[model samples]
Target chain A: MSLSLNQWTTRRWSVAEAVDGCVRHGLQAVGLWRQNVAEQGLAESVKLVREAGLRVSSLCRGGFLTTGSAESLDDNRRAVDEAAELEAACLVLVVGGLPGVTPGEPLGSFSRDLGGARERVAESLAVLAPYAGERGVKLAIEPLHPMYCADRAVVSTLGQALDIAERLPAEQVGVVVDTFHVWWDPQVFEQIARAGERVFSYQVCDYLHPLPADVLLGRGMMGDGVIDFAPITRAVLAAGYAGDVEVEIFNADVWAADPDEVVATMKERYASVCGF
Target chain B: MSLSLNQWTTRRWSVAEAVDGCVRHGLQAVGLWRQNVAEQGLAESVKLVREAGLRVSSLCRGGFLTTGSAESLDDNRRAVDEAAELEAACLVLVVGGLPGVTPGEPLGSFSRDLGGARERVAESLAVLAPYAGERGVKLAIEPLHPMYCADRAVVSTLGQALDIAERLPAEQVGVVVDTFHVWWDPQVFEQIARAGERVFSYQVCDYLHPLPADVLLGRGMMGDGVIDFAPITRAVLAAGYAGDVEVEIFNADVWAADPDEVVATMKERYASVCGF
Candidate 1:
């Protein structure tokens, strides 16, 4: 089993440091994000990743469906272009939520039109699908956890993601089965099975106790929470996916620790827990 | 159009006091929890409810399948007996989770094979179903939000609840479609439509801020969160459900305030938002 280091694992590290860190850790594959691509410039970021002898497993994200604008649409399409240039495996989509304010107040009118958000997301996906297909960079729709339904992505379940995937004509439009987002679902294994070849990437993660409102940074290290990763990984593999089980944790505590230590510990823990 | 005051609306009050308060506020029906019955004793509680000319829409609970001891089974069967005694319209089931603590921290086990928890719940349901049938109480399977998957009920989605309902030999087992838990679902209408006569009771609620682990007591009031309650109520009514649109708000903030004020505001909001 190979390991893919999501740049988010070392979120504190710069793009250059992130590439160097992944390489130093002997991680052969790395997923780069749009912000870093912008900072380092697409060509140099691509060059840096190549020099580090790392394969781009996936590009971090593209679609944020709710807060749609000409600028956001153009930016997402540009993200697809960058992924193609980097020759990444898939462009992971975050798929946005409500129109504004990032859902700070729980009581705000944060867009209850799930159908409207879903429609906008689907429309944006259609716009990006042709570009993704032409560039040979797959688009993996990452269904985020339900906690983020108001601000992050409205796609909270795998079956819902598959429903979206099935409607799209793009052969490259697949689903990213992140354990952190989907492990709570009773339909998880069944949906993973239904995903079949459409299963693009598996993001292994866990949740922490005393959940915080800013869930973006609260993700647990594998084996830290209740997820039975081994059984889930077995299901993913059994579904005909041969991709690297990408360890994508967003814990502030883990990130606050030294990057080298985090990477070393993550590798050992991933193999030990995942039985790699 | 009618207003039902769930006894939980005046949880801190005596059953008679709650009913009196509801009557004072022109609220028609009240859903009672097992605890309320325990506090007043069932006979007195029912006497109080009936003498007040109040409707008992549902008995707040029944199926807690987490327990396997013969004593626990007997206790739940007793809850059904009480529901029957009260002439309750339905028995809401927050089907149980992990059986016991794993002894590590002398604390709860977060990962006790949820599928196992589910089976235990189903088994408990099997044991309790016949008793419920004879008692003339309808069992409404309340699928708690996924956040409660570890500590509370393992039934987290309408789909899972409906699957269980479908497997049962009798139509006695159905579901409680609460907006608090399922409003974010992509297939809300689809599942509601499938629920048919099986949707026993519907709770119209809105989520407040992420509750502090200590303050799970206070949920959000209606129209105070991201829920678009209008169309959903329309859909549930459209699905041929003429049962009480029970307002079950577990909000500490509202609870901390005067129960009288809470009831009045909830009545106004429910009328304006759901037009009940």
Candidate 2:
């Protein structure tokens, strides 16, 4: 009942299918992705989850904010609007990586200014935080694993995310403590304690070794990889976050499996590993 | 002249060949790997570099201390002996990752106790540091990138490495500032300043984007990836680290290229980007 299914764990499932899967599994909450919501039509998507008696725990990202461009800001605002419409707990932010470095191009052909990119994330968050606050929504900044620092999110640790979050209002901006990303950090427990009430969301996944060719899709189910979930879960709980613990995996193999089976396994892993 | 070539950059070259290449490039130093030295025979390796008037900048590794096995300890002791004989600046320690987790096995089947593994590293260092100091061979702990934290090195941050090193005698235990490993850290500059005299070796290479299938072989030559070198180079220099700046790369493509051309490119990049 405390477990939430991040739609990406069963990436192939539609909004209706995912909600149905959650209902069948006795899950009380679901995390929605922007693309899936748009595909199902935002109104219909919101209605589908609401009618199924499922709470929207968090929305799957709205922060590619490193560019600070009008287009990106507009997109983020729209994402915030969508999160508000679904009445999601928070808008998860996968803050964009360094600007102008596209894949398959000459490596680092553009700006390699990581500090500048990080500053831009702060700047954009400042702009979006108030808008979200007015709409009664919280923005959650998810610091990705350091491996993704170059091309994904420049925010690479929970401490760094907290640093950025602390600069803004705690009520408007906070952090997501994703197990797969922050488990390797030596200061993880300390940072989780420091996160306290700013902990808007707690997502779970495992860090698979012999990382696949596409490291992007390398996340494993809870018991399948190197993460020990109980400590992190307890830390988040101790921080006073009595929210849905979302199971968010991005493994290619997981996405190809049966949706129902994936949901079933997720429930079992969450119950066993999360220590709830 | 201050730039040194890490032997693994041209991994195909013999110890003698690497030494010759250093002499040809007007480089004053070379960072040696243990296997390469064993291949050339330790005595001959010492003679070859000595005769070429090349300073052995630092030996490429001596710690797999996470296992805390007697065999691992013995092998590390032998490595220290080699470094002392070679008169290298330090024995670079790529401390082992989590214990009992071999590749191609079940992921979390072994201990997920990162704290325990780290404590083992500290214990191994406590035993080995005195041995290294007596031999006048400094043990340089290289905090690998977080991506490698699971299977390569438990020491994933320069600050963490410093915390470990501060417990031992500064003369015996130190840290390596490898750009490829530590560039993503937010506290890099602050930690570098704190490192001061404890900075044993400075290794340079760029973090390539769209990491190759094998992330281990993903380092790019300076100026080829997403790192702004001048600031870090300046920071290390400001930290009072005047040792040879070793160009240590490990890309499969670089390995397959002409060693002469690679050396030439390394020199040019070092001169231009390193601000020497």
Q: Report how far residue A102 has shifted in candidate 1, in Å.
A: 1.3
What are the per-residue Cα lDDT tens digits for candidate 1 across B1-276? Answer: 366777665568777778888889987788888987888888899888888888788888876676656876887788788888888888888886555523123335454476887877777777777778877878889998776665667888998898887766445788999887897788888899988889888887785544434424435778777777887887788788887778888776777789899898988898788763
Residue-wise lDDT of candidate 2 within B1-276, one digit each (tens)? 289999999989999999999999899999999999999999999999989999999998888899789999999999999999999999999998888766445465577888999999999999999999999999999999988887889999999999999999989999999999989899999999999999999999988888888888879999878888888988999999989999999998899999999999999988888784
Q: What is candidate 1's lDDT per residue for A105-200, written digit by digit as tens?
A: 444445567678888888778777887788887889999877677677888899999998887654679999998888789899999999998998
Off by over 4 Å in 1: A105-110, B100-110, B169-171, B209-218
Q: DockQ of each candidate's interface versus the true one? A: 0.42, 0.65
**Top candidate when judged by lDDT against the true structure:** 2
RMSD of each: 2.5, 1.5
The parts of candidate 2 lying over 4 Å away from their true place are A103-109, B103-109
Lowest lDDT 10-mer window, candidate 2 chain B?
B101-110
Docking class of 1: acceptable
